[model samples]
Target: MDDVARLLKESWTLVEEHRDRLSGHFYARLFLLDPALRQLFPAEMTGQGDRILDAIVTAIQVVDDPESFEEYLRALGRDHRKYHVDAEHYATMGVALLDALRCTAGDGWNLTYDQAWRDAYGAISEKMLAGAAADGNPPFWHAEVLTHERYGQDTAVLTVRALQHPLPWRAGQYVSVEVPRHLPRVWRTYSVANAPNDDNVLEFHVRTPPGAGWVSGALVRRTKAGDLLRVAAPMGSMTVDRASERDILCVAGGVGLAPVKAMVEELTTWNRSRWVHVFYGARRAGDLYGLAGLRELMETHPWLSVTPACSEEPDFDGEHGDVSEVVARYGPWTNHDCYVSGSARMVRSTLRALAEDGVPPPHTRYDTFGDL
Candidate 1:
């Protein structure tokens, strides 16, 4: 095997040998070394430590494949951005990671092994920093709840007044919300429903996922006006590429409309004269939100078309079927850049159907809610 391959194999083996200790020590070292990061993490560091170790080990195992490694790392970097992790914090993480490796390797961890791992991590870090820079290192938003409107029985739409100058984010970018819950503060990511230029006020459409943890449940039950929620700078890659100049197809399922709503708003604002079609899916008519606003936009902007699809609400006006089916009927998708947002299952199935219907993968973008 090549030198790089051999080094990767050895690193993998070493990681496996000291998995438990490495996981434990890595976070311990991090927290002890950087009290700032410790503050950001959960008070129950044990569980968070395991998560960090699992993420790192998964990343390291994929390093031999550059393309996949880079993709994985980019996703990690994007996710971390929501946590407001800066380059300095990443440096601290790297140090902790290396120290854990050293402890795990014992006497066998010499200069050569250390150097190889260092080089690998340095490269990854550099790429991560570069990606963040390219994404326009957006500043964190300090927001106060302007109004919290209960939409349906279980959903709330929060209008926040941002304290900082807003960044130009595409639709589908999510903002991390830090709420003072039980303790240590808890963070959750919510998609922005309002368009980008709606600067002073940002809107979030949130639903109470059944059996969710204290953070989400509390937010649903207790969040009220005048409350402050720490928000991260907008971060996401699932954006409409306006440079394409191609027609656009937007698909949204349930609350998935949040991100797509942002995109559609942007499109309507930028090209009030351009034609775009939107397909929204929900189980029932009551489950659908923002249709009236979308219809208003369509009416005001002559170039826009809105199609609502209800799977269970058969009596609903407009389309009646799965979103993918509605999208197929509206083809040919090859002429448009298709944007999808919803649960992973819905996004995957919709994308697959779109591809099968001749929509190229490059022309399709998606944002899946919940855990990665």
Candidate 2:
């Protein structure tokens, strides 16, 4: 390894040694220094602190190679952008991190150690700031529930009126949600299902994931019209290229349709002439939401086509298999830009299948809806 990489690895080891102390001290220092940030964090600082520390530790562990590290750091920057974190907050976080390291490393934590990490953090934060600037500062969001419609048992679609001016975002972007007043305010990320337009209203198609947590369960069961919920601004790397003329192939599994729906809507609005093909995968007919609306959209747009794939369809006509199988039957997807959104495993599997079928990496994109 090179000198910088070696130094980063050494510093990362120190961070792990003092993980608990560093996490405790960092949050304590941040909240104590900036009482305003206290509102931004969950009421239960203990768990939140640990999570922050874990992210920091993981960030440092991968810092040896700047190229590989950039992805993680970029994701962190995006998450912070949702919170409207500025340069000052990043500096504060760096200070707290360095201080915690100094306390933990004791005699071993010298100026060299501090300088190495400070430099690393500076580079990372610079890239973050640049990215934010390019994207425009997304406001910390507050959602006003305008309308809620039950799709089926345990599933609902909410039309939220974002209180602040939202950032310019493409379809397939996601935002983090938190209920600050609630104890252990669980942070969860949900896809923005609305097309980017002047409507100034954001829509989310939310379903209770199996073994739902408190926040998600409550949102599905109890959240109602006029209820205000804390939302982070939009953040995600997955999006349709409005500028591209290539055919767009959207593959969605389960609730993965949310982002795909947004993209299709945007494409229609843009009058994109390239053929847009949608492959929707679901386990059963009941699992299929938005099918009728999508069919109507396809009928109205000559350039769009909708294909529904049901894995458990016993007596069905049309595509009755996995999404990959349907795609294969459609034949030669070589010229299309494919977007896949679903569980991580599903996304991975689909991407691999696409690659094996001759889709280049440049033409394939996916988003795994893992924890924020």
Candidate 3:
């Protein structure tokens, strides 16, 4: 397994830089092999190539760990059900992917590398097939937007209720959402901002900068109450461990507060002794829209405390500098079960700080958004 993982990683470098060409070749080959499969994908195909590459890269990174590898591939399989993928589709995809890799790598590709990927893809497809066969839930859920509240120019907080079927999700998991009316077949992931409940409602906090993210932009700027959305299966591992007695440390930046808020809300139900400290930050005071709700939660849950910070607004009456720096000033968080969610830069900085504080890697979990 180690040798296979090593070969896969080394071979990937030969074509990772030429991802666009590789993806183009892969898709072309796939269509040439079976024209019918092209109908499963979106017509635009703007960010579609990157999504497939990201999945492959992630699979490569976790291949050596059997538990995580199987779990991730299975979840990915369940998520791909939204595209109506089946066993034969996986086999065809593997063939196209291998051909593209070989063509992109050219002379750098080897028989060992080819064999490694073949074995790995076999395992991947098998696990994914098992996951798809085991799932009794629908490929996607139809959800009605119950409310939409804008925050500044680029952010919105919205709630939706799944229609006809229950969408079960853990506190820190995220699900792929597609706005069929705006950008059909284009799905973007958003963390569920609330815990599971009998009401079958879910909340999402979105921050879409100008000209970026088709799905996010539509959700934030164009979506309104009564609109319908397609919600896919949830996938993430940042949830709290109820059995662990350690104190909790949560650091959130920008719209990344969604999952942290959900975890805290879940903890509120049965927590009595554990202390959960949340450090929420944004570039300016105006962007810290979720701080008010966190503050309100603190009023009722004595064990919970939230510290809001603004990196760009010095006049605001709270901590200054990056949220990661604020967390470092409050550490040593080595004894706590730490969870960090934010932009890639913020999560990276906070993870570095936690590592510096001697926190064990196993004790920390993180979710990063925006091109990570």
Q: Count the backbone clashes (under 3 Å) in each candidate.
A: 0, 0, 0
Clashing pairs in 2: none
Write the residue-wise lDDT of candidate 1 on 1-372 in tens digits: 135545856766866866778888888798889977876777755445555666667666768777767876775665566566788988999999899888877877778778777888887787777666666544355678888878767677888887765645556788777675343445666788877665567888877767544455556668899887777656666887767878888898877889888887777667844468889888888878778988988888888888999988868987988888888887888878888988777788789889888888878888876531
Residue 371 of model 2 has an lDDT of 29
Per-residue accuracy of model 3 over 1-372 as CA lDDT, tens digit each: 999999999999999899999999999999999999988888799779999999999999999999999999889988989999888899999999999999999999999999999999999999999988888999999999999999988899999999999999999999999999988888889999998999999999998985668899899989999999999999999999988999999999998999999999899888999999999999899999998899999999999989998999979899999999999999999899999999999999999999999999989999988842
Candidate 3, residue 299: lDDT:
98
* Candidates sorted on lDDT, descending: 3, 1, 2
- Top-TM-score candidate index: 3
Give candidate 3 misplaced runs (Cα > 4 Å): none
Which candidate leads the pack in lDDT?
3
lDDT of 2 by residue, 281-344 (tens): 8778877887888998988899999998888988666689877777777857889999998767
Q: List RMSD in Å for every model shown.
A: 5.3, 5.0, 1.0
Report how far residue 360 has shifted in candidate 2, in Å.
Answer: 1.1
lDDT of 1 at 240: 75
**Candidate 3 at 327: error in angstroms?**
0.6
What residue runs in model 1 are displaced by over 4 Å at the alpha carbon?
A: 1-37, 44-92, 95-119, 129-139, 164-168, 181-184
The deviation in Å at residue 134 for candidate 3 is: 0.6
